[model samples]
Target: MSGIYPFLTPAGDAARDARESAARELVRSTAAKAVESLELRLRVLGTLGPALAACAAAMATAFRAGGTLFAFGNGGSSTDAQAVAQVFRTPDRDGGRPWPALPAISLTGDAALLTALANDVAFDVVFARQLAALGRPGDVAMALSTSGGAVNVLRGLEQARRTGMVTVGFAGSGGGRMAEERLADHLFVVPSSSVHRVQEAQTTACHVLRELVRAEPAEA
Candidate 1:
């Protein structure tokens, strides 16, 4: 059969031929997945106008009131949580807008605290207990869960609600329990089952959210 490696003559090494074929397939699949992920990100962002605006408005209000933001998640979502906190705490300077840093915290940042909470208490209460101690009225709770269904994440949202904090969620796969329970005041669900695509969309959503919040006509 014809192939990209034309130099792989019919009599060439069989192992090298197999490797080239695998490499070609890998390149093709990776490009396809990358394009798919980008498409999903755009689609999600396009549909996020209303919800994103509402979330940004609420967050801006909270910030105006001197409220802090608390973010949490699990596994890769935990990394996303940290990214969210960082993006808010340190506005990108590349925009040349000279935006002020916002108040944000990642609940997963403190390994000691998380481990202590998990070990001393149940894993589900890690965020809950922290919220109980640190969260206050008018604060914001942002939880990231590709599946929309981490028990600890759900508990954190519940705690945020009980404490009068604005709740936001980045979830995927039909919004899972977070949607069913109506935990977040603003929930953005990327209806895909692929975790990578969901996360890519969520990251874009977060950046857009920051832009919206900054665009709000409120005194800093």
Candidate 2:
């Protein structure tokens, strides 16, 4: 078959021919996947407007009231939770910014606390336990779950609700149990199969949520 290496082959000659061909093929395959991932993210952007705005309102209310933000998720979603919290806590603005540092905490940030909950009680209650301890009315609870149906994620949301904190969720296609159960007050679901794309859109949605918090409410 024809290939991109034909015009200028590596100097190693036959010894590197097989390796070079394999590398070229890998690049092509990865590039195609990247294109698909970008497309999926674009498809989900439309669904985020309302959900993100609603979430922002909740977050802004928390900020205005001196309430803290508690964020959590499982696995890769865990990382997104951390990223979202950091983004909010670290704001951007003109003249070095005027808003005070928001108090945003990630449930996954405390290793000892998580291990203790997982060891003593149950993995499902890890986030629930923390919320029970640190959360109060007026706080915001943000959870990231690609599938949105993770048992642990559900438990966390349930606990957040009981604690009177606003619940926000970011999920992939179908919205999983998050949508089914209507656990989150503000739930955004990406209409895509690729986990990467869902997360990419989710990250953008998160930043937008922060922006809305800083933005003046629309005149109505």
Candidate 3:
């Protein structure tokens, strides 16, 4: 029986051992990368200075005035926009002052409307058209773009500005045209070239801004 079973063979276990080793190495590498990205974001936070403060103030102003926040983006940025809306709408319910839920809408939430805008007009106007229809003066628009070169994201911010809404863009990799043209009232560029790093950092910034807005009254 031992011979037939190859003596509970060490050779049979080679594949499993190698696979486990590879998996462990991958986990270590990924964790290291995540920590590196987080460290970079922390450095950014320390030096962001008045720009971050201004963004917080603007967010607070919109909230105090009973204005809504509209977030829009494309691809991964679209998901980021939705996530920002979620955080504003749903707090953690942890031990803290129960704050009022801020109103935030993700423009990329509706597929039918997006498709219609793309098919009827231009693809670049998908977000711009939505902003024109739903946005009003005093509203805040948060535009997310990892590269910051996405035409639709820029167009959306431009339209929001034209519609008299305060525009804010979260971008990365030198902030592309959003940084170049100063299209938004506030623009934040995550200090990383990797899309994943930029995305994670932007989420942190958004959450921090939300907290500042909630605490603005006490500051004043």
Candidate 4:
């Protein structure tokens, strides 16, 4: 009688085992990279303190001078863009105060407008079209892209810049084309190649920016 193994193995047991082990090692390595990426983001946050303070000051100034905030993103990033807009539009529950005078719009929110723009013009014109219609000097355009090279995002940034709006880009992977083009007035780049990791950092950055804006003194 042959001894029975509890589990059945593939015909190429040794090769299968080796491949499985290699896969596990790869997973572990990727996990470690993700963790390191997060740690790097925390470290970068420390350096952002002074710059964020300056951004808050600048935002306050912009608001005082009567400006709005416009945000745009694609796919998952569109959700983040809307979330950021909500943070500005809604009242802060902890503070019990609302930023009533400050206008916050997400270019990705209106499905009808987006469809019309994409159909009538082009997909790349969606955000740019909205910016052209709504953006103004002293306003802020916050664009998010994990790859940092989305043509539509770049177009929106260009439109915002041309209209004199402050162009802010949140991106990943060395900031891609945006970094090359130097299109944004302020750019936050998440130093990770993994899409998941970059998106996580982008969400965190948006939350931080929202908090900074909320903490600022309301317009008198």
lDDT score for residue 13 of model 3: 77
Instruction: Give the poorly placed runs of model 3, Cα more than 4 Å off.
Output: 1-17, 91-96, 218-220
lDDT minimum window of 10 residues, candidate 4: 1-10
Tell me the deviation in Å of residue 94 in model 4: 4.0
**Per-residue lDDT of 172-207 in model 2, one digit per residue for the tens?**
989999999999998888887778888888887787
Stretches > 4 Å off in candidate 2: 1-15, 95-97, 217-220
TM-score of each: 0.92, 0.86, 0.88, 0.79
lDDT of 3: 0.85
Summarize candidate 1's per-residue lDDT along 1-220 as a digit string, tens digits: 3467555445558867876887799799999999999889888988888889999999999999899999999999999999999999995554676677899999999999999999999999999999999999999999999999899999999999999999999899899999999999999999899999998999999999999998887675
Worst 10 residues of 2 by lDDT: 1-10
Q: Clashes in model 1: which pairs?
A: none
lDDT of 3 at 6: 43
Kindly state the number of residue pairs that clash in model 4. 0
lDDT of 3 by residue, 1-220 (tens): 2366443335557855765676688789999998898897897777675787888888788778888999988888899899889888775543677777789999999999999999999999999999999999999999999988999989999999899998999899899999998998888888789998988888888878887677677333
- Which candidate wins on lDDT? 1
